[model samples]
Target chain A: MNHALDTRHAALLLAPLTLLMLLFFLMPALSIVWTSVHGGQLDLAAYRELLTSALFRRVLATTFEISIEATALTLVIGYAIAMHLARLTPSARAVMMIFVMLPFWTSILVKSFAFTIVLGDAGLVNRAISWLFGTETPIPMLFNRVGVVLGMLNFLLPFMVLPVLGNLLAQDRTLQRAAETMGAGPVRIFLRITLPLSLPGVLSGVLMCLSLSVGSYITPALLGGRTDMMMANLVDFYTRQTLDWPAASAIAMVLLLITALIVVLLTRVRGGNVEVL
Target chain B: MHNSLPDRMTRFWRATGGLIAWSGYLFLLMPTLILVPVSLGGSQQLSFPPEQLSLALYEQFFTDPSWWGAALQSAKIATLSTMLTMLIAVPAAYALVRGDFPGRRFLNLFTLSPILVPVVVLGLGFYLNFNLFGIGGSDLSLVIAHTILIAPFVVVSVSAGLRQIDPALETVATIMGAGRATIFFRVVLPQIRDSLVVGALLAFLISFDEVVASYFVSGPSTMTLPVKMYSALRWEISPVIAAVSAMLTILSLVFSVALIHLQKKSRGH
Candidate 1:
């Protein structure tokens, strides 16, 4: 009857969610590891093949390459925008944040589809090009590495901006004033003080973007050429196309490990705050 | 006032920075905004400015069984999944917030681990596990998968809500001879109603937008709207798909505006 229950009552209260997670969430996730190892009685053949196969290795490399590219692109653009947003008055910021957050709230499918239209042959960019320069042929943008990165940036920018913006907003205003009083120019103060203070945010944003971009299946599959397949697509390839559960599970495990490694490294590098999530 | 070279250089840099940042904002917004006009295309081919504006795509979306049917199926699944996620998440949120127990930190991490795991991996895992149970493509399987996908968000939102309320409220209820159920329903629930609604909205939106996991677990009959759009995109480019995208974007916009309003209201309380 008391509000604060003993451990027994606490456990009872937690039982339903605990059971739900254990049965559906934990069991399904654990099955990936099981299938990865026990391909009919304790086999590591999938992992061995993954190590030996050029195609899998190439895909893994591409995943990291694309993720890094996307993360770098997102950070540059996101930092610029976050810098601008941080300087805005609160009322103006609220309005601007709607724009930043709207795309994030929308489905990734819708965003991808929009990118196809905006970057496709008869899309907006091509139309603008024709109108501007009288070009007859539209430049290809939608099915290459360019398109993949562009599509990814649309979804990833908000993740980067929000975090960096948080850190920027949290900075002491008097620090900048102090630096200015010391005859530091705006650029010098920003470079010496603001940039260093905001590195944790930039690091976390990089982490978020990289992890999301690495495990992304939709953007590359929709926008990239066949040569641009990432690890997630490889997982999908084995699962849907080839029906090789072990191979799929192996790639998934690798992805899981990469993501875990990123989290661990970033958190540690950021002085063990663990707030990257 | 001094017209100094350094001041002029600073102004120039500020202008350049604003231009770069505004361009980034434009890039962020362009894709979403482009869908609205394209969705109004009069022709069958997808294009910008649409050549001629019409509601034919919207008409198609409504009259066609595939589009509207998938919409209905998504709504149903999201509703059910939201309910299931809330049911499991609310009490666990209460336990995490109020009921002190060992391994609470572990429990918190476990609850949120699903969000950290890759969806593609979760999809395959769900496919394998559900196939083992012989319910791989059923609506039930999709619902369960979705609940797992969204339960973490519900837990986080509800737990935040629970944290906001004073513990003394519960003590007062207990002192007045109210049981746990009465204290929760009467004392705690009323205070956190706004956040409960927020959690439900978030769960519904997340479940509604989910595609990767549903793509694996759902059969042809059980395909949700996003999954249908995904397949449709892979196979062809139709104006109606544009309409679908526009509608979904609007849905997201509406939900987000509502969420922002609710969050402000909750925080005010």
Candidate 2:
């Protein structure tokens, strides 16, 4: 029968993806799990040691702080853009989407390089400020938390806007139109009608922004100074710097745990669609 | 008659909202666009608004042998990985979209799971895995690692495209005595060709832009472009960085426009 042949074709098709993922992805990931528990023999000592370290605590705290701050700022900026996009005609939306997606598609290194050009001591921002205000001092923009957040916010804002716009567009607009016809004040109409309706998008945007910023390494590494460190930086430090594979694996597990727990908890709370890309 | 209190208030609100929205868009574009003028900068220093307009940075980047070597290595890796990823992902996407296979959800999750892990961890995994294989310093390892990183994008893109197609056409092809492979090649593949092209381009971009994994796996002689850029940013501010930034931005914009145009054309059909 055709059904028999179709099943075989399906299995044949799936074989390569299965094999490559198992060999390349699953095996390497399992090896990390194994490494975390085994130095000479099976144990949880690596994770224990990692948890007990002051550096671990500081790095985790910093990662969360930066991610939360970045997500908040991105939500504000992204919500505005998505709101604007939600009202546009299809052709105009396409053009605006290109600009938003440009930074998303560009190399992270190139985007960070742009920050180096703009936010450096002698960079464009500093140069402009000096000219405008006649200040002799160049602001300490790069190599700090401000620089790190600014760079990361550039990347995360687009992610927030896209999904929010999708949700907003899919939403029912009759209620808003009815409210407008009923003479609800503009600010009151938005606060009472649109904002409440878009909460799912906002929630999804926050989760996406938070998860991405939490794991981000490149932006912070380029923009932040020595004292500013995140969880992924610690993972890199152990893997590359110290060659402590077990310790690195342990920290990675912890990082994954934090991110997964937050995502699971949020989905449970809101029961919203969480389509993060 | 339409200029009531609410209408007037909403118009003002819309004006401010548009202002805020455009500013946000500008903020997003500012970093990438700032490099354009700097790329034309003549002075050796990485300064804004060049002392004179010249293409020295571009000239410097083009003339450097190491830069060429890195670019070549990146091209080789990206092309190889893109080919391999499509070879693997296209079939998988086909199965996921069309098959009555069991454990389909699990298979879908399995393909996308790589993205859930932090890239730093993924890089370390590749580094250690390669070392264990005793192929730690080779370009083969880089290519393989990049394939794993990029294959998921191909799968997802192809899956989306396949989902857009109607199932009735495929069934008709099969009922007309076409074999599965023939149907795929003649009927299905043609429909999803745009997806295949866009997915391959995404795979290439992901491989080309990947730095963390390349940083770990790359030996002294095999650094990729982004890895080289990272190292340059670490030691000194090379004026050539602006040129590279400008070039990469152009490449990305062109690729993105191509992707969008292809998708729009496909959707029009």
Q: How well is candidate 1 docked (DockQ)?
A: 0.64
lDDT of 1 by residue, B1-269 (tens): 54465477767777887998999989988867788888888657888777788899899899999999999999999999999888878988888888877898788878877877789989988988998888889999999999998988888888889988888888987888898889878888899999999999989998999999999999999999999999998887666888999888889889888887888789887
Give the share of true interchain contacts found in each model: 0.64, 0.61
lDDT of 1 by residue, A1-277 (tens): 4456668767887899899788887888789999998654678999999999999989988898889999999998999899999999987998888888877788988998888888988888898999999999999998899999998998899989988999999999899889867677768887999899999889889988887889999999999998899999999999999988899998999999988888677657666434322
Candidates, DockQ = 0.64, 0.62
Model 2 scores what on Cα lDDT? 0.84
Question: TM-score per candidate, in order?
Answer: 0.96, 0.95
Any idea what lDDT model 1 has? 0.87
In angstroms and one decimal each, the interface RMSD of every candidate reads: 2.2, 2.2
Error of 1 at B152 (Å): 0.8
Clashes of each: 0, 0
Query: Candidate 2 iRMS, in Å?
Result: 2.2
| Tens digit per residue, CA lDDT, model 2, B1-269 | 85477778999999888898998999988866777887887647777776778998888888998886788889998999898888888988889878876787778877876766678878877876788888887888888889888888888889889989877887888789898789888998998898889889888998998998889889988899989999898888777888888888889989878878887877776
